[model samples]
Target: MPKEIAGPEVTPGARETQLGEWRIVALKDASFALDGGAMFGVVPRVMWERLTKVNSDHTVPLATTPYLLDNGTYRVLIEPGMGLRWGEKQTAMFHISHDEGHELVTSLRAAGVEPEEITHCLMSHCHWDHIGAACGADGLPVFPKAQHWCPQSERDAALHPDHLRRASYRKEDLQPIIEANLLQTFEGETEILPGLKMVELGGHSDGISLVILETAEGKAAFWADIVPTSNHVHLPFIMAYDMNAALSWEVRTKWIPLAAEEGWLNLLYHDLDQPMGRFVVDAKKRYTFAAI
Candidate 1:
């Protein structure tokens, strides 16, 4: 049985705020080492290191593989964490460990969900770590029935990537899904199901996407690696992993208000301590993380 990890705690006597009615699930909770300088963009180490735990090697600890649920009809998985394909060198560099079963199959099974149960397999982008588990050990579609969605431009970039971007696109990790004829490309905003919508956010990676779920309570936007963690809520805390830093800032500026004004619960893919939360703007117009 999958052990239940504690959800974010609510203060005593605090009224329950219904951001949305979806049944959210945390699939896998793990960490990755990212260069501290890259994680904070232009922010100096002095300011960024205080918010995250940085090792002597200057890598920041960020969460991996968190997902959500929407009324049973839709099972949207944001990013599948680093999978089993990494060799010793890569593994050691990223400090990858299989002890927690961060494997997508294990996490999904633990949640009582089979691959086929996932109606839509959303990609934050095609970075090897994010989409590694989209295919299995052998080259085949992990989710046989689900459509692997990405923006048209990004799909093109992945297929015919420039030399600079090619490093992140591991052929072994994605070829199986492509050969299986399971990849589905989309442009702009797309509604995969009744209440589930995919929004295009380009920055961290090409064709980066986020899932927005509308329910009786309100709406929830799964911000995959865009606002990767609670620490990244600030506008300038862009990732070094992003291809276009300026564009990332543009996307974040636009989405922050849309989330707060519309009361969209912000679901994060890599916030180790608090994976999901709502964005609140205080009197000073600064954003604060309200754990859900």
Candidate 2:
């Protein structure tokens, strides 16, 4: 497990570590809850309810975690986070909670980073929660100086979502990036930076992608929503929110083992308890996690 910046005694707050030449910092934008049934897909409530606290509304708490990778020159931010544009209804529905200054930029500034310093903004997908902070309430790109990137499909989905995915994407959240000419889109897999790449996997959404960073230290993966939290580690534990459960299973089957065997430092996006850990496969071939 990577050491917490505040020391071992501190359990909550941002975590920082050095991965090869990059300085990685995990920042929390907001704490919210999602429908438990929607989150566990085909898994029985009996199996998952015991793993985490469930609110009276049957929602499971989750954190919107955005990671900042800095190596003096380029500062790349992954996952823009659920910004503060929700209305009363949406806020109440999600049980969103955060301190006064809880937006991604606020969290970035708290970590000694200003919005302008961000060189690139990477997206695993443009689901509202993952890309909400890309723009501000005034409909402008928040990180004006950063070149925002995502799969070409995600950009299309965000701009013109079908009935099924309409709610997951908000045009206002991504339009400004396009208008500002800051949005960069790719297909299949592309390395946006040296040692950093985004691989598109459409299981979660039409064009959702996963990020990979490799260096002398090792490989690190950002498992956006595929294996959202540590609890979703089971092979069958796909999320109902996924666009294609079968594809999600296949993706999980392939990557989970590779991550375990290769000893990649896995960064989770929605886990509330622990965001960073390494996959561990025991003799029985069952997978588990060892916190970093």
Candidate 3:
């Protein structure tokens, strides 16, 4: 059994929803503020600022949200929010600010789970925010009993990074996990569990993946960074941080239409307002993120 850790009080809308065979719970952790221009990619600030409140510095607040998938037998955690390992300089650089007691581990505790109780830590990519909470300050896997899964391509990139965007992969995040022998890497669509599988949707990162599973209603998909926020459900709303902008747009246009048609409870990673919602196609054939 794992030791209990207290989490910050749950805010409104932080509850569980039943999806066929599984139950999904949305949990919020830390937040980081980033420039709106960078977040909106090619989209003009004038347009995005209108949709979201933009600060004088042209920055927008992003929520680092995680999800807990409970099927009564297993508990799988997707993308534990940015860990609380930043020093003064890093804190200032990333504009990292967390709620009172809502760090990743604490958020899990808030959900009545301990770190060791997590059976799977499915990472979408090796981005710091996505993998930070996997390791502790002393460089050890936080979820000692869980099977930590990472894409082989992402592991290679993080270990041997190139010049561009190298800072995004933090050593503290990967080194500890590797040392603990809890890390498992895979290629293509892999079935970590019977109903849960990771689909390669590489646009944001070379090896980023989207975790999808069958639900009683339809299907639930964690599209990862391809659609970080519900607002990014729009075809062109991609982040400039994507390594391949063309691929991002291509993938989004292709799969999102299918998602809307089939009705997926999309769990977003960075949407401050809405965490998970369904998509509906209007008469214009445009996919809109409908709050459920």
lDDT of each candidate versus the true structure: 0.71, 0.85, 0.80
The full ranking of all candidates by lDDT, starting with the best, is 2, 3, 1
Could you arrange the candidates by TM-score from highest to lowest?
2, 3, 1
What is the C-alpha lDDT profile of model 1 across 1-292, one tens digit per residue?
A: 0022123333322222233445667677345677789778788888887787888888877667657474556776666666667678977787766666666788888877888888777776777767777777665677888777767766666677898888777766666777778777788788877788788878877778878877776677778778887888767778877898888889989998678666566777776667666677776777767763
State which candidate has the highest lDDT. Answer: 2
Residue 5 Cα positional deviation in candidate 3, in Å, after optimal superposition: 37
Give the Cα error of residue 234 in candidate 1, in Å: 1.1
State the TM-score for model 2: 0.94
Candidate 2 residue runs with Cα over 4 Å from true position:
1-14
In candidate 3, list every pair of residues with a backbone clash.
20-216
Instruction: Using TM-score as the measure, name the better of candidate 1 and candidate 3.
Output: 3
lDDT string for model 2 (60-108, tens) is 9998999999989899999989887889998999988777555687789
TM-score of each model, paired residue for residue: 0.88, 0.94, 0.92
Specify the poorest-scoring 10-residue window by lDDT in model 1.
Answer: 1-10
Candidate 1 colliding pairs: 38-240
lDDT of 1 at 73: 66
Candidate 1 residues lying further than 4 Å off, grouped into runs, are: 1-21
